[model samples]
Target: MKDKLFKNLLHNAKGYSVLNSGGQLVKGYKPDTVLQKGNEYIIMECDTGTSRKGYLGAMLKAARFLSNEKKGVLVLVIKEKPNTKVKQIAEHLQEYLIWLQPLTNLNIVYLIESNRYCPDENPLELLSSEFITTATIIKSD
Candidate 1:
């Protein structure tokens, strides 16, 4: 089920791979899926229906692991659109992450709504150059 979600969400990606225990050991951390485009790598964490706390905690943990990384994106993929309170929490997490960038050296973090894509939406747009401006996932209605 999760695999299908990742495949559909990342279908437009040039290439990607699912990480196993060995892969995680190699990378020092495991993301549900990993997408590579050119020199960039996107490590994604997917959650079915975990609490907002769990979601943000996992994202923070990933950032800590990637503290020395100078590139790449940490993407948090959730199965549904966040509720009002969760959205607020995400906003707070965004602020905290931005502030911690200098210390962690983690570049970007994207919070994506897995089921919100339309045919007209380009998944790659989420990782476009302009993303450098906001560094936050902008899910469409």
Candidate 2:
């Protein structure tokens, strides 16, 4: 039930699919959910686990390359909503973001849990918001 619901909500996002050297789409990477809005392209890796340093860096690197050529936002959406887990990921993602901002046109947004549209002033400022206000504002305009 949870997976089905998530898929439905997530399916609305569509963007250019990234192709590899072999002319195949990458395995773990998902296409940007929202199109280029103000030169901001959001790429979200909807993970269902706690993020690790290695995994974050690897994902960041991939996003960096894509964002450079495309010029957009790179978001890492995690499913771990527990307080401690969220804190840990926020810290790591921030650290990774510092290094990545200079190299690529990437922006990060994390959505922990969602059964419905989240209400918040700005999820970018408030990481725990139910919906991505950044996406909302970009699309509305």
Candidate 3:
């Protein structure tokens, strides 16, 4: 899933160029993927539903990066809806970093697979299609 997302962002997504990726270190942090569109940058990380500690670290790193750069958006992609605790943590972080809210944004993308009647739906389609759509909206805003 992470691979697909990276590929989509690096190749399929228009107007975006890959800056750092594949766990490459950037300013002492290794974001899963970083993209640039003009002067704006985006830092992305994928949560594999493994550890909350790791997720928290990613959020903190994003906050730090934004605080320093004063631009870009942090995108955290998850396989399902975040639990209550995760939501609370995110809210608190946002409140604490309210000053950076205008210059940067934290966007969460839930990649929940549809279980509806569509038999031909490819599960990876969401990563390829919805991700770019979401990113485009975020960038536009």
Global lDDT scores for all candidate models: 0.54, 0.43, 0.50
On a 0 to 1 TM-score scale, where does candidate 3 land against the true structure? 0.54
List the candidate numbers ranked by TM-score, top first: 1, 3, 2
The superposed Cα distance between candidate 1 and the true structure at residue 80, in angstroms, equals 2.6
* Candidate 2 Cα outliers beyond 4 Å, as residue runs: 1-40, 54-58, 81-84, 114-141
- lDDT assessment of candidate 2: 0.43
Best by lDDT: 1
In model 1, what is the error at residue 28, expressed in angstroms? 6.2
**Model 2 Cα lDDT, one tens digit per residue, 1-141:** 133333334232343432212121256544434333344444444445544764476456545555545755444445545643544766556666666666665555443432223233222322224345433221101
- Model 2 misses residue 131 by how many Å? 2.9
Give the clashing residue pairs of candidate 1, or none.
none
Tens digit per residue, CA lDDT, model 1, 46-101: 67665777766766665666555334667665555445233554675676677666
Q: TM-scores for all candidates?
A: 0.60, 0.51, 0.54
Candidate that beats the other on TM-score, 1 or 2, i.e. the better one: 1
| Candidate 3 lDDT (Cα, 0 to 1) | 0.50
lDDT, residue 1, candidate 1: 26
Top TM-score prediction, candidate number? 1
Ten contiguous residues minimizing lDDT sum, candidate 1? 132-141
Clashes of 2: 4
Q: Is candidate 1 or candidate 3 better by lDDT?
A: 1
Per-prediction backbone clash count: 0, 4, 0
